[model samples]
Target chain A: MTVSKDDKWTEKKISRREMLKLTGVGMAGVAIGASGLGGVMKAMGYELLEDDSTTAQNKVNFYGPHQSGIVTPVQTHIYFASLNVLLTSKQELQELFKQWTPLVVRLMNGETMVEATTNTRVPTGDTGEAAGLDAANLSITVGIGPSLFDKLAMQHLKPTALQDLPHFPKDQLQQEWTGGDLCIQACADDPQVAFHAVRNLVRAASGKVEIKWSQAGFNSFPAKGGTPRNLFAFKDGTGNPTDVQELKKAVWVDNGWLKDGSYLVARKIQMHLETWDRTSLKDQEATFGRHRDSGAPLGKTQEFDAFDVEEKDSNGEYLMPDTSHTHLARKSGVQMLRRSYSYASGVMSNTGAHDAGLLFISFQKDPAQFIAVQNSLGRMDKLNEYITHRGSAVFACFPGVQKGSYLGEALFNAL
Target chain B: MKYKSLLSVLVAGGVLMAGCGDTEEAKKEDKPATEQAEPAKEVDLSAELAAYKQFALEQMDQFLMETEKFVNFVKAGDMEGAKATYAPARMYFERSEPIAESFGDLDPRIDGRLADIQEEGKGEEEWTGYHKLEHALWVENTTAGYEAVADQLLADAKELHALVQTVEVTPDLMITGAVDLLNEVSTSKITGEEEIYSHTDLYDFKANIEGAEKIFDILRTKLEEKDAALVTTLDEKFKAVDDLLAKHATADGGYVSYEALTEDDTKALAAAVNQLGEPLSQMGIILE
Candidate 1:
């Protein structure tokens, strides 16, 4: 499926009310309150509302109950940007989201941010780097950090469950990489597409926001296809909940303005490849408590075969070592969706060591689910010796946007 | 003394006899061996390499002394004193960076920045060096929490001083080290990423150029013997870079804060460095 240039030109003329009607969301559904409606309405002038392109290949629908990139099958590449808001008021923040709504929709539909203009004297509307690329199943997820509330004086609207992650043992968090007022998680099958989505969005919002820190990451799948291996060569994301019902229970927030929204916890974990490479295959397998080849539990044969962490051999020894990463994580008795990617930036200038690690991202209904599991693995997991947690952030990702409404409209309506 | 002179003359005659024997063998091959009649003298670079090692050791010694004095000011909670010493202290390290980087892990332990440590996925505790203290003194505006960092900076400086004596400086090292010094300036120092908080990047910038020039000076005679035009171009280019840097120099033999430079100033400096770097990169190939 492909969208021709002529189709995009006509779609730009579709009015907001017409767009809502086309998407089956009646006028009655939008309940933007009186207090912040003016700024949101002003932002409406800039909106380029259009239906998701059905003809576009590998496209994810923009309108949904929950955001894409969370439950959407993991993409091969990600370009995550943590930004600091330069705006002052809550109304301005709402306006910024409203402004971003249609731009994001256009990006997911595999179209440029706006129609091409013949005027060559000025800078182009969209950065043309992603011109020849498809949507590549691109997903853009935006979330507000805990600090954003205090900055905008909207602490009352902030979720009680949304806060920064507590420092765990062996955390070497650097301030430059740690906190941010907002974050953009752009993922796509093609890295250039993912990076282009972010680059264009950030450029569109130039002075209003600045990137505090960002890391680009990727995953390589086997030719036949399966779970991808991390830098340590162990299959990752094996324990993620696959059932829709389980995903809903584990991930989606159920109440308040944040209903259907989930918490995102991002950790910049630096894996010490030099140390891991020196260990024997047996010891390496013991570190993750999974076979390096098949990604199975120690006593299990298949990749997905489940086994009890407490189950012991005839010798009364636990099959999975009590100190293994998977064992402790399982012992926590909680789950979250792990959507992570590996990053190899280059060598560290001083030590000549590879500057590589996992950009560990997880989605959960509450941040506590992630916190509980991390606490369980605290200091005791053998994996701790080979990894260092260098950065951390938690953000309350908004629920998906319905037609005629903007991103985070629920928060503004509650205000 | 008379006996030693006689022994040296005997050794010189034996070397002459060996050369004649090689020339005779070449004649028997019946090829046009006119060039081999008097064997072309090999340019022995051993003396130059030894001279470069001595210069590097001197730079390391100065780095240690200045770093100790700077660390003392930091540990005493003297903010102004520490800030005053900071840029001057880093000058020595910047000058001797090639030799300092030769040792495994020592360079990073003593000179690593916050970003460097972050890249290694290590904690803030692992970050110990001049820049770490530079952050506390300049950005944070206090030296209260960096007591251990100050002590470690001194210890690492001492280790670097001890390590320099053991370096087996070679011709390749001298050639490459010159290029590396110029690269350090063009990449980080020009951008003001180094000395980010203090804005004293010009100090390090000048030092790197000086270090690279020292290498060129030692190899000047050998370089001229091969390519005299290249040697002349290098001399002029080096002077151009030095002249541009001289514009930013302060009365105290220090440089103006990197932040004080206008966009035009930086651009001109960058142009001069690039001009020098192109000709300087050829030194290795010419020598080989």
Candidate 2:
């Protein structure tokens, strides 16, 4: 609701105690007392001191720099999502939108919409010959999935609950569920920001909604100070291209463009709990392209250790197996930022009747860059079969996040 | 602000990570000597941009008309519609402004919208973040010139949607997906884990990608409408982008521009753009 160049928003640099305060999880803060806190602080490269208050209340986004992430983000979004139960009628939807009007007052700490005298300054110039950044805008879409309906059926003990869920032939299970098929898309400048917005939204919809997943979407690199558009765990995308073809030209029409600069990748990651658990400590490390215990390269225990492909075995072959998951990932290209996530869909029938698995999603500037690594994985990938894909969506990432705007809006605009 | 490369952002972030983590003790990691190395060369990214210049003028026309329309309503005291479109319009401009960042110095039309706005926070719901254009469309009713041109942008967006499936199952997607799934399980705070995710949530995402690829093949090689001239340029572009991708990709995974961006180098940019780019504001989105 407030916007100012002064950047008065207090940088929400959550400390160990703050995280503990937010998640209300373990004694992470308590155990890190004095020296412990100091040790943790040492690791983070920050002094325990911080200024909580702001000089002016005009800045909506926190301006302080963080230890990690791009200091000044090209793209920054903090989404706020709410999972509301589907109203059977359009009239109800309209009413909800109406409800949002009055609620902004409560949601924004009493800030009211005002026609201000001060004008927001903007860049005024010519749009040159090159393609503009299209990823400035973002959109929210809603859909009804069978699993959602099944969950609803389960809630109300609906007789046709089983039919609603994707995994339906179980006649007995079907009769005991309340079907549902409505979902919402809430977003903003960063996943962290989205969390705030979504939290408030869901809170407002408490009785009228049955909250589903409220995830921080996409693992991007820090486009803004919030979340990485390519949030590859273990810091992927240490290398990538800065420029590709201009947006105005066509790759197909353009006769002379570099094939090396762009990339495309697709992967299906299946979680391996049963098989992974069966493996010994060393075997587990081998399965993942990295050390399982330390999340490091195959030969090293330290996180973010430099990978040396030349290290060899007695046979003069590479010490790290060529077929190792890590090896394939390395071979394709380093332009990838691997931000990933996981899911567990209750328990399955002992016979594995369930089709539950991982939904793989990866983003790169060019699809071809990740294609080589993908080809290496084929069906023989170290972590295959254990994970299965179900729902998939792809978005051409726009340039980056812009201050005082939502993600991907510009691209959506021209469209 | 010109568009800086993602590599630049990541490289900049790496240097900033000298102090981080929740525990006070975790904030003090040893700063490596190499971490202090020189950054890449800065480029005039805006000079490389391609925006729809005509679209800006059209948007402005619409903005004026819509403003007049809303003002007329306001004059008549039609507060609801005026308020209804207000927030949406404001949010729309805010959201759409970032696209100009990529055009560091290239496009003048994009620069215009980024630079000036008569109103700060005003517009409709659906129009939020794209206020400039949406205002032009609703209030100004300026689509006389662009009603036809809009099909191009819409068609391209659809094409991007159709192309998501051109990618298939691979290690990168798997690694990325698995990581995301794990994060979901670990961080979910909905109070009832039982209700949030079904087995389909796990597998459906990959299934959707697989399905999208099938759709891509039809759009690219098999579509009857694909050879219809309008999309013919895709043939050359895809091949070029594909080739450039293979060359610049890394041995350990990451963007190729990583080196150039951190060191302020534009070698990768020039090489990639010259090798893989087209001059038409190429807006391709892929799903794999």
Say which candidate scores most in lDDT.
Answer: 1
A224-259: candidate 2 lDDT, tens digit per residue: 333222211233333222333422121111111111
DockQ values, each candidate: 0.01, 0.01
lDDT of 2 at B263: 19
Q: Write the per-residue lDDT of candidate 1 for residues A140-193, one digit (tens) a residue.
A: 999999999999988999898988899899999998789899999999999999
Question: What's model 1's lDDT at B39?
Answer: 62
lDDT of 2 by residue, B109-154 (tens): 2212322322334232212122233334545544334332233333
Off by over 4 Å in 2: A1-196, A199-270, A300-302, A308-311, A349-361, A399-409, A412-415, B1-288
Per-residue error for A34 in candidate 2, Å, reads 49
Error of 1 at A182 (Å): 0.7
Q: Model 1 chain A, poorest ten-residue lDDT window? A: A31-40
